[model samples]
Target: MATVAATSYVMYVILRRDLQTKLGWPLGAVCTQAAHAASASMWIFRNDPNTEAYTSNLDSMHKVTLGVDSEEEIKKVADKLTARNVDHKVWIEDGFPVCIALKPYPKEEVKNALKGLKLF
Candidate 1:
């Protein structure tokens, strides 16, 4: 058990670094890393704190179904979020934002979603 635990910890660290450098995803953003003791407690990092770029991106892509007029716009939003390594989900009825819950989230996205943006 001890050996397995130690090995897991080492692998986790290595993978975290690789993912960040390769995919630009923050260590905490990944579910595996986030589930760990160390990475789970880390502080949130943001490139733009004043925007809902993350939520908007997820909502735009995952929430909306195909054949909508706003598909282009939503795709753009999703692209932006992907560029930033943000993950989210969208609603089929109305481009609602679904996302992983985290502490100290991008305040701007919360505010934007709060304004009748439909977040879940």
Candidate 2:
């Protein structure tokens, strides 16, 4: 059995589902947007307390990836998070938004903000 690491913090990665279905983007390219969103958010909030704690134990760091139906859907989530002062980054490709990643934060503090998303 694999070990489960306990931690209070989590990184939320939200990607556009249409990238694969409607947009016909290659899998690798879609994955790259996720990478860009995550890394950029991590760098931007590197100094946050939760981020510091989350990175301190890299092996146990927790991440949750969710999917949205379209660019507008993803942007809606980002707006909600921004209203709550939740640190995050939205990645844009070719002038269209495709992904959003939230900085590490206690799961409880951010769960409701992400309650509407489905696992990717």
Among these predictions, the greatest lDDT belongs to 2
lDDT assessment of candidate 1: 0.30
TM-score of each candidate? Answer: 0.24, 0.92
Question: In TM-score terms, which candidate is top?
Answer: 2
**Residues 1-120, model 1: lDDT tens digits:** 322111111101111222345456565554343344222322232343312233334333111112112334444544554566543332222233212223223334433322322321
Pairs with steric clashes in candidate 1: 52-109, 62-90, 63-90, 63-91
Residue-level error in angstroms, candidate 2, position 71: 0.9
Model 2 RMSD vs true structure: 4.4
Worst 10 residues of 2 by lDDT: 1-10
In Å, residue 36's CA in model 2 sits off its true spot by 0.6
> After superposition on all CA atoms, what RMSD does each candidate show versus the true structure?
17.5, 4.4
Q: Please write out the lDDT profile of model 2 over residues 1-120, one tens digit for every residue.
A: 753233678899999999999989999998999999999999999998778888888888888889999988988998999998888999989998999999988888888888868999
Model 2: residues with Cα > 4 Å off, grouped in runs: 1-6
